[model samples]
Target: MNLKSAWSRRSFLSSLGVASGSLLTSATAKAEGMFGKKPKAETKRLVDGNPIVPITSGLGSTGDIYAELGVKPLINIVGTVTVIGGSVMKPEVMELIRRGNEHFVLIDELEVAAGKFIARLCKSPAGYTGLVTGGAAAAMVVGYAAMMTEDLEERIKLCPDVATFPRNEVIIQKAHRYAFDHQIRQTGAKLVEVVTREEMIAAINPKTVAIHFTNIQSDRGQVSGPETVAIAKAHGIYTFNDASADVPPVSRLWEYPAVGFDMVTFSGGKDIQGPQASGILIGKEELIHWALLNMSPQEDRIGRCCKVGKETIFGLLKALEIFVNQDYDETLRMYDARAKLISDAIAKFGVTARPREFNPNALGNVTPRYSWQIDPTKLKITGQDVMQGLADTKPVGIGSFGAGAGGMRGRDPEAEARMKAHPELAQQRRRGNGPGRDPNTFGFAVWQLKDGEDQIIADRLVEIFSAAPKA
Candidate 1:
């Protein structure tokens, strides 16, 4: 079936399930009354129609658990971001996760089976397979550990202390170094920084385990992917590509490994809409085997903390299956429709909302975005003001307006202190108030918004503009 049909069916089934649960409750109450016993008091439920599993009581529910705790849930306009919670799981994926919880199985056998399934689905190069990880970062720790330790139990136990190991160095481009490198560093391997192809070649020595390529920054570095692969191949060194956020062309899932990166990692939670804590690592069979040995269901290893549950593995597999087969053109159209709805609603307020064309080669979280240009002459409020206004909306806050303006709502004194201590961090705030950071403009992608959220956003925008004074 087409993606549109599949999505419609999934939504219908989800609604049917909720309706069935409600009907069951009503019938039970009626039966109790018919038997002449007083019907039990109706218990309040968490908003969003899903009762918290294991069902706790005494929680008043005008909203979801977030609201119960005085935190506002948001209409996510941001692409998959871990801070606000990654993309929602497809109904089928959630069903698989729930099903997986019903029976216990040997995690080792499950991982191997899942790996074979992933390898076949993604079309990884021969001698390569897949492994579910805690997250993309966990994949790095285990992938690097696999290269450094191989299959030796003695070496595995002594990981992160590879001071005496023959291969403890990872080569990376100077420009490619980012926050996620901490994962590589966690394995106790020293990162050898190289700026040029010649420098990379010269830096490789007896200790070099692999060349770490940051996929999104492939163009920024002097050495290209093919060149890096060639260099690694020539030297008999391993290569790993951190392509976590790179998908949507879905073909990239196998393409990178096909290009000779011995290991490649992707965030299952991001575009795949799998469990938030899950990731996929596909690479050489030998390396993946070593990675698995170092991770969960094993003891006293460097990756012991990075455990992947059976449910998460199943959910990620289902998500991957859906993601690969789903239609993208239809998805884009749905996003466009959502943007147009919000745009039309606020047009009278002099805000022009135009959709940005999707770039096929966008580095990560690829999605079409909508840019809202506020006509200063028609509306006194700036785009940042509108963002904040949306964030302050009642019932649910519409968010993902780039950090301080709205994305992070609560006060964070610790973060403020860190910013104060590290003045350069001020420059790191996303899309700061400078060029292209027009005060009269703000934008976000609509693909992440749930059903009917676009209308809520439209109604909220109307409320915000209605309250703003005319210019």
Candidate 2:
């Protein structure tokens, strides 16, 4: 009866020959390109470009809980990972950013002033420099430039052009290859990916600008602090130890560089609670100096693009002072408590949930992950469903994907039962298609959860579970 149905008859078919056919095709096929065009591929950043998810006011500016037949969603128990723009700035950091915004000084002078302090904190020898960049990855690129060739002459020149100086190849292990390796290329340095101790050692040539050690322990090529620094030293190559999000178990604050790695990087926003756009690039003074020289406010410098607002730099320093001295053990205990909350929630669902303590020597950080074993006969969801469901939520959400080895959706016998038993109740489920109770997906993350939000979660879950049809 409508246009589509009307098109099936002979008259409609006859009309589809010439001019009419073109119009029909245009309407039928979306004017060739006029239909529902899918959105562009999404990046790590969120829709608004600013990456904070409002905890109190959600996507719709509604309260955390929807009427949900009378239920609120659960508080996040997950740590502040990317899906959530790292972590919130500590109050002290926020205040500093606010104050710094009020005035302007020579960015170069600011760099000079901050560098002195950063060098002292890292215990690097003089000429130790300070540079502010968007984050650790930015630091890697800028730092690479400094170690390669400093000053105007070589700063702009890249490898193959400078035969006399180090050609600047960054060595990374096969197993230790990281997502940020691409950052090194930004500086015109080539990345030589190697696997095994032999390949790593042999891979280093005179052209090598620096040897990069990704923070991890399990990979055979994963080096200890002493070994990594030692190898780079023998080759006269600068050593870069990248400990991206590996904070917590505070000893690491002084560990990597202390072991002699020439340079180190840390995220300011993670455990440090500094500004989200901030991070710490600590190590040899001279290299840092050169690195600092390459960033914004320095015209035509190879490191010119990455800019760290003066406020973010200052806030990072303050956050570091607090982070390095705070009661680290207390922080770990809080994480433990959060993990326990997730486990406790899962227990009611009849799933055996346990906290997996991460090894510091391995990944170089100490955070806990919640691993769950659900019996599938009772649950109908799949991990993919859960991830998609969470993403589809009004406010949208994110969490770890494919955590454990076994797939709960496919093999678990009581997965459905486990979903039903969850304390927060999966029955009425925040009232959308619940993540298909996927086995690979654990219930949810404890990362995003802050102080005092468990009850809303409990009530919401109960509502979801309560609404389900009786088996």
Candidate 3:
């Protein structure tokens, strides 16, 4: 409606005081979805003069000024990782975070209640856990304490010099100890590395706290998942699993706790869609309770450093909810289709662009990693050059910089099963040249792309590959 019509309606409502729920609902529905154009208010920004902009807003963020000027961001052909600001959270997560912003609640009580619900979801033994440090690395540290401290007072008295804390040793397979936030050491616990099952078993003693398991690291690790946990439990020690970015089965959240990984640390920013700084530590009820009691702001609280805000909590919860209710089988299929599109587009070049399914053994992304191979010799440009071109193109930023290193050569993974099925592809991939010899592989992740964005990017990639001169 124009100004006059809007004014007339406002005047009528003022006298009537008819603030009907139906009217609010209908108006919001229309404004949010049914309306032909999105509301300018969708883009909120902070005011320069004031820290919080409750009043005036500059025209810059509204996209209105930008639309008039013709500007937009490149499509993100990646998955939801913190570096990319995480996948634009699901709509519900944004709404929940907004609700949290508008309200207040007791932090202790909030954590307590949230823990109960989260634990139930994961079937964890802990009451619930919290991270103050803002990364899953902190989650591992705080979780390490949950099992070691033994009680509330001891939990409070954490971080004494090495001589002070009892059972200060944490055994990790020589290979499993990768670049985590060092949560285990955060407890001031010592790390003892063993190279074999014999070494691990021999390493476990009275001081042994727990065995750490890392799922994503590629190095040949001495400890296997089931074996690490089994060994720890048999010796009455705890098992902590680090499954960051390994969130495909979505069911894995609860699966870890159920399978007896005393504490499992997950990247909230990467997969669970929680705050980049927040990680979830769920397992053993007694341990979870201790972990919370040890969390930050409590006097001498060991975990006083790993705090999560109301917004992060709500957003994380929302992401998890989508993960829980999401049709995994269908989502996987969609990613499969996305990979196939690019693969099929250039398949005529005699290169195999196949969809890599999500299997635990695969080194690719948690979701299916669609990769396309190019005959490097036939495509005059190096894979890196093509990557640079795509990045420098009008719609740049397709995948990671690594994918540009000519297909398959730059750590792009092959599904273990697929590797077996396509033995020739593997041998060709390991030592193939461009086009005829080297099948240029492009691994595509679907989570990062907005709706229908894959088409534009995939098509653009096809064009670049088909057009570029072969090396």
Candidate 4:
């Protein structure tokens, strides 16, 4: 049936308080309990000072909300990507979000208070502070806007239209250019591409406001972070580093700022396990002030649309606190144990699961990976087939099987045609340590998986191998 018809049917059934199979049953139960008889005072007591607790009584827990909506939740084998809901928030962070929702405060005042807390935790430089944004991309929009406008009320409102602005150019390395540059371009500043140190030095003109650095691709470019910072300082231009996914060593939160980048941004959602829509922007006090003026709690500005709720801000701070103070070595050991559980389960099927260590100082998601080598003589299925099998599991599909291609660099017909014409280009693209590229091997990281999820994956893998056709 059509979507409209289906929605109408669901709505009609919901109004009558009738359970239409499993789809509407959970939602109906929730609605009825909202106006139902109040619970006993003893039963309503906060657990461990937490105001919210899981409902375990009447309708026997409202059931899985995803199941009710017919949307299957997946076991995240992917480290931390937005497509799979990033990371789950910590219990403390969730408590803070709940607490934050209980009252209303001036957004500006709350943001300033939160910024001071972030600055202290991150060990930001003497004159630097922090600002919570919608996300890393939102941080970019405001960061750039801050440099271009600089607390000028007139320029803030007329931003993304910097015709009259004295400085409107952002210098970036040619190799560092990527998809997120679109956020920088949103401020109406021209991105000046530089390939070499000499070119970068030459590009610094009166119109240049800042130098953009892509933290993950630092080695791919001619200039390093220190070099970029030095050059920006010499020319009296600001520097902004987009280090969104470069956490988990956890020191990068303050390291980038200490390295002298005028501004640095990290994704609060990814490894930090904060609200999915939040980000942390740490930078000089003046620039942060400009950024705040250009964003929400202040309308008629470019970043007015990038509004970060109070709950999200509080959640981000709490998550950051937990992340910085976390025992990383213990976390790593836990991940290893989880991988071993899956490895031991499928070993009898001639699948050798070996641990792959991750470099702690790596520029991107730092997590240990596990690769399973399928024995072709034992099972007719290839590693890609096994990946598909896991993804096809019922109730909750398992994901992050493949190498995760085609996510950001979406379908480009022209690029595809070029790769097709040149076999070497295609070969180059396939060269990676990730799984699903080879017929015999498939792998994924277990750090993103929640408690007991590894067992579910282990059982699923056994089922796939056992049901496969004999070679």
Candidate 5:
């Protein structure tokens, strides 16, 4: 549209009342102004006197990828676990990765640059440094190799096959033994499990390389962090704490190591919201240096297969930057709001849903938790039925019943027998959600619900209850 043609159309529209008289007049003035016959209206500015423009938008959607693959993405009410692909990374983290894709840098050089930033972010002590690895498990391999040797050449060569090495034992509290202990053992180190501090002290023979602790299991173990670190320090052994899933009061990243542990590993993907495949291992500078020697980029080392790409490192770095400084109180309030929404939604139907405080053992989804006491008589549906319905729905919503309600009960001999036959049963038990232990009580996490997802969940629940009970 030329200005004259535009004005003629506007004038015709104005005569037919399709355009307002003022609009026609404004169009005529714009036409005259374009020809320099009239003064143009001053261009408007935003409050800050800057030109208003739409901010940049649109990265391609993963939904398309999943759709093309004939797979549906599940709603993550179960929290950030490896099976569910961990929590989604922050926009800042993604942006860092987006920009990272545009360039190429030597892996070793990039690690050095990224390491400094991560060290500062994790508040690593002046003598300590940090390295982003392939998730918390990979950190185990790196940390194990680091503690295995101070000699760079020996460190790289001895890993992935430490049969000839003298100090090949990594002491761990029997209670702290977890699925990821395999990551540590992968470096040809044997895990020596001890129950008591006395046992741990006694177990730390000349062959002991380091002591490992699982942060979530810390509360259960008799040996406190300080005690473990003290024993390790006294014995001249390195201590590595697997503080993987325990985050959200993100201060724990540096706090654990600051308390005297030689190394601490945290999942970059979980609460820290980095790349799902990356993690942070921050501790003593010397140990981190040795670990870097044993990591990827040096294809001959034990952790060579634990390759963390340039994008993942940068993503973890950015996530750490935002995580530490983020307004956690505001986040908690949002979580609280989501929890309340679900609790409130179910309350009207005689179901008792309450927002529960976050328990450290809840792992990845550590925001406010919501548990429901559904009276089967009132709703005419069992908690198990509700769980199954939600699970069967398109874009499945997974939730847990009362803690330990789902999964193999330790006390049940049959459950134990079943666990041995199906090793995955053990994983499901640890996941905190399996078969409901109670028919009347069930719960779900709220923090993992994306915007407007709570409504979908609530509607789904209402729909399930609305249908008549099966005879």
Candidate 6:
């Protein structure tokens, strides 16, 4: 049904059901933090830091979903990552998505309208446009196809079969060859790897259609952004960058394309807290025009297989708006406060936790996290044991609570390369014998935690340590 009809039905239901005022009040109460209200005697904390609070009393409505499903919900102290279901959507984004699902509109028409709005906010240049896709990987597929050909018939009909096309090669840095590059290759474009700036310059040829750059790999590559864009522009080749997680320095939303890349894709779900299946592709309008020609709701196109739903498109748009207007400083302060609370909970045990930069590489979650330094001699339990204990909890608490580089299970080649580039981080990772030696550290992040949940996490850690045998 159309949006108008849906709204009419909702209005009719509102009149028959409990009043809208009561519904609004219920929602407001659910949104408010339980701990934000003044504490009663039962909830009050004593000088010893332990509180006699009940878990179910002041908790919000989130428990309802897991409780009904019979799935225990764990406290996520890890930053936003896809494995943990990305970031939790804000109520505003979720509401738009719910409303969007009620509407019936031509998908292409929605793209045009939403694209215009996104383009305006992105400050896209004249001849530049913006479009949403089913996450960053899909954007790469669509964006690569757009730059490869302008023939509407070929794009609409038998596109991914680009053997007839001369633009068959995509140039990328060897260091930047991430798993996401598979998205670019899905369009039948061969990825030509290059190491040094000279190699990259040499790698470009008549077969080269576009150069792919990764913002996270920027620190690792020898070629600079200006150089990559300039070389691509000189040869009249397009540049597409996968900046899926390089946000907050939210200025990055526009900065990459504004500089020179022909197109750039950002994940809607990662830091933006948009729909998990949504993403934005912002770049040259001519290219975007071709991209839309190859996009969904269009039958005869290579991108027809990758369809983005209406709810995701509108939801991402609202999420982008909220992300753009968010008070970044205030958000950072909240994250720091969460980290501090976790740190303070374990202070008496001689384990010092503080907000510090955790991962500073392309593959890592580059953000400040609560890094805990443990004197293993003081506690019989090792950091890995602590990690295993947390993992064993009823509703498992997932965090960086292990004894490796950045608390990762095994060695990561990308982290190793990044460590080689920075001598100090390499030395820091080495506890004694060599680089792979287990470091006596564990960490947690608060960027993904919802309100009133930090205390739960802190209490969990305390419980784990309290049960540990004293050295």
What is the C-alpha lDDT profile of model 5 across 24-128, one tens digit per residue? 667878888889896666443212112222323332233244554565566777788777677877768876786566467798888878888887777877788
Query: Model 1, clash count?
Result: 0
363-394: candidate 1 lDDT, tens digit per residue:
87788878889999988998778777777777
Provide the TM-score for each candidate, comma-separated. Answer: 0.84, 0.67, 0.71, 0.83, 0.77, 0.77
Q: Write the per-residue lDDT of candidate 2 for residues 324-383, one digit (tens) a residue.
A: 777756765775676566456645645465446456444643555555655455555443
CA-lDDT, candidates in order = 0.87, 0.62, 0.64, 0.86, 0.76, 0.76
Candidate 2 stretches with Cα past 4 Å from truth are: 1-78, 120-130, 157-166, 196-204, 222-225, 339-365, 371-444, 469-471
Locate the minimum summed-lDDT window of 10 residues in model 6: 44-53
lDDT-better candidate, 4 vs 6: 4
The numbered model that scores best in lDDT is 1
Off by over 4 Å in 6: 1-72, 358-366, 396-438
- Candidate 4 differs from the real structure by a C-alpha RMSD in angstroms, to one decimal, of 10.1
Residue 396, model 1: Cα distance from true site in angstroms: 1.7
lDDT per residue, candidate 3, 1-471, as tens digits?
011112355445643443354466557767777557663433232221211222224544442453435642445555765554555566677667766675667776776677666666655544434332356776776677666676658546746344566687888877776757366776778899888989999998888888888777634786677888788889998888787777766767776666777777777677566556666766666776677766764557677777777777777766666777778778767767766666666667655765464565443247555556557666665545555556666623565433333254445365777989978767655543334633245555666665676677767777777777656
Model 1 local distance difference test score: 0.87
lDDT of 6 by residue, 269-325 (tens): 888999888889998878887888787877778788779888898899999999998
Worst 10 residues of 4 by lDDT: 41-50
Candidate 4 residue spans exceeding 4 A from truth: 1-62, 400-436
Pairs in clash, predicted candidate 1? none
Model 2 scores a C-alpha lDDT of 0.62
Return the candidate ranking by lDDT, descending.
Answer: 1, 4, 5, 6, 3, 2
Q: Which should have the higher TM-score, number 1 or number 5?
A: 1
